[model samples]
Target: MFTWNFQYISKARLSSTLKQLNLSAEQGDILIRIHTAIHLADEAVDLARFVKELVPKAVIFGTSCMAVINKGNYALNRCIISVSTFSEATVCSEVIPIMDEYTGTVLPVDMLCGQIKKEFVRDNTKLILTFFSGQYKDAGHFVDRCNDFFPSVPMTGGIASCAQNNQDDFSDDGFVFNEKGWSDRAILVAALSGDKLENLSSFATGARVIGDESEITDTFRNCILSINGKNAS
Candidate 1:
């Protein structure tokens, strides 16, 4: 496994930095995850595209994130590329459409689980990394269902977050991008499988909340209309 955190300027500089990896000569099954806080869909796509062009055989996927957190530290307006090569494991990735285009309906979790299982044996599949758009409301449920289906396998990922728009609305601020393309209503999933594969480990930062908890009295959809009987700021 290898990771790079850098402030991306242009394709020329990106190419120079990527050369450090020697991806050209690197062989074996590989997966490249590109997470960026650039706040632009084009930037995310461009980054993924360049990496995929360099190693077309690798399973490349990622999304625009609010920030990059590594080893307990975090940064914004930067990009992170994580490359993992496996000689004993199998990895597959795809954009799972969670909502119907024409019908405008939220698809069931069954379809999502089907796609993950269809790529590898359910018993052998050991790890799953899923990236969902910030606008995707079903992300939480998706996790729950995956845990129900793949009881032994570990699942991890986060929402693709973006800054609020000028009007303070977050309707379409985030997206998921892969080698093929980017989408807002879909999710990117990578499934790994191998006889020796293990996904029992995980970690978190030392950050914690210290302020007093306030009671919420009312709510409007996902927003809080009032707290402690007072209007929410």
Candidate 2:
């Protein structure tokens, strides 16, 4: 079995974030999620590169979001770094641009899943932490395909949002990146694998309705495909 440790740090404390992380052991990852009214795409690239320089070997990836929350405080333009160090587990990263840079075409769902299939390991893959482009509304389709191919390993992640300020202006500036490159229309994926790697993601909202369990028979990306043989509204 492998163990992992995480620490969430704000931009104000970023200088020490890496030092505090146990990277000396040399097997870990650094994930950043930035949500800023003034966060520029170029700045994100710089931040990713800067961290990569320091760690040199850790898998680094992240996404630009509309808002970022940490420990109880919320900030629109703050940089929050989520660092994960693992022992007895391994991680790999992939950044796939859904939009064809040459032809300016959007990749279809099946094709996108095909790209993942090339590297996906059914049994060894323990978890999928991805930051998907918010522009693509077909995330549910991707999830469905993943479930079909690798049902046992849980997939978890968030959709990127480029919206900024009170006007909620969503632009094409949203991006996801890995150590190799960054893309405004890509999916940043970090796959973790281990025989006993467990998923510990959870949340609680006192007594609030969590909704009833329902079987989803179909889906079209982010839209509901079907439920109990009935068309989803």
For every model shown, what is its TM-score relative to the native structure? 0.76, 0.75
| Candidate maximizing TM-score | 1
CA lDDT of each candidate? 0.74, 0.67
lDDT of 2 by residue, 71-125 (tens): 6776675556666667666778888888877998888877877777667655777
- Residues 1-233 of candidate 1 have per-residue lDDT tens digits of 33345556677877777676676324556888888766467656777888778777788888876677765687766667777777677788888787887898988877777667666436788788888887678776778777676777788888887642221332265788886778878888888888876667587799897789889999965589998999998
Candidate 2's TM-score reads 0.75
* Model 2, runs deviating above 4 Å: 1-13, 25-38, 166-173, 202-233
Which structure among the candidates has the greatest lDDT? 1
